[model samples]
Target: MTNIDIEIPHPIAAALTILVALCAIVTVDHFTDFQASAGGRAPEEIVRDAEGEGLRLRQQQAVLQKREEILRYQLEMLREERRLRGPGISAAIEADIDRSEQMLLDLIRDQQEAEGKIMLTLKQIWDAQGRAISISRKAGKGVISLTWPVEPTLGISAGFNDVHYEELFGMPHKAIDIPVDQGSEVRAAADGVVEDVSDNGYGFNSITIRHNGFATLNGHVESFLVEEGDTVRQGQPIALSGGRPGTRGAGHITTGPHDHFELIVDGERVDPMLYLPPVPN
Candidate 1:
């Protein structure tokens, strides 16, 4: 090896260096492209997949949010019930409380299934209530007379077809809500036979009394004092007022202790105030 010195032009040397750098870059880019293609998805497909995943996550979040809301409401009911459970409770009442708690837990586990069952139960109860009213209309042939179901001392909390109720529950309130103390006496609005007593498991326990050409429903009752088919006189005690959250008869939604009263005339729900005496000042 004989050593010979050859000096190249600076401009040509610079051009060669740039060319080599360009080739390296091209090789690296090709390798990266091949690696990406090995996954059997194009760049656009990868981007689309990411977008789809994000959408799915968002939908799942929405479902979870709704579930959380339902759980919160149920939990509030549970807490109220627990608070109402005092010491020295009777065994029968304790067992009922346990069942109620279990029902709430089951609802939390399977909301959709529980909701379906509740809807079905309500439908059946509603049909029975309607039948009771129909029977009353057919059985009697006298003029309608009415009395107050509860003392007018508390006045009315919510009225017939209450707009606020419709806004809150998305349905018109066909009855009236009379604010009364918990465990207050609920009296019969008129002389009638007790046709039905039922509970809808959501805090609505009611008694329907059939009178001449009309019917009366007293909801949010703690307990029935009279049994079905028993004749009751006007101003007679029929039930204890409820509507206290977490109590025996107070359903899921209630503002406070009160009575939900309905008066049906001609098979239609009308304003109870129209038929009842004016509230005492």
Candidate 2:
């Protein structure tokens, strides 16, 4: 019987080690199913997706911000009531104030979160005119239809009366006044570009949208949602009604909180009832 030890040279041993490492790497790579840096998506596609997300987030944030403003305004009203009512109604007023305060706080938090999301979205990636063009295409489908600027349940407070101020302006009172609760949403009558959003010299916040062969004016609004030059679809909220003849953001006078809706055709004031459907009882 004999025992033998096989000795290998250092160079051959090193070569064997290198071969094993190469084989291990190839096996791992083959089994792993590796992906591209962008997770098999094209870089351009990723950018486009990010931009879309950003746009959506911005819109959502805007909505949340509007809600916050409404809550704050409500809170102010509640406080004013509490002050005027005095302790006789303190118990009820206090409860309402407490609830309003809580709601306002919650809305603020939500708005902050939405704002943060928008900021993060912007940081991650990203079109103003392009969106407007897309909206235009979508709005152009079918014949243009108009939606009631205010809820139809509320009937016209003042019927169209052109002769009321015919001397000052031949077509004065051409617009019907549809009274609604203050701070109520005022939507677009039809798809169109926001031709103007003016507060100065008008005595009230007003939004005018030019549609096909006609235009609509929404006045006595508390606040505007859409800015000048923005494209809005029918039924989209353009402003909040400033109910009553109160001195709101603009000093526009009204019998009460109402939506002053005016229709203009070929730059001439016309009765809105001519085109608007009758309100359901």
- For model 1, residues 3-43, the per-residue Cα lDDT tens digits are 99876669788889999999999998986887577585776
For every model shown, what is its TM-score relative to the native structure? 0.58, 0.46
lDDT per model vs. reference: 0.71, 0.60
Per model, state how many residue pairs clash.
Answer: 3, 3
Q: Residue by residue across 22-141, what tens digits does model 2's lDDT show?
A: 999997675454325447675577788688677666654553444444444545655655676677875654674576457446645786653443343223211222222233333332
lDDT of 2 at 236: 93
True-structure lDDT of candidate 2:
0.60
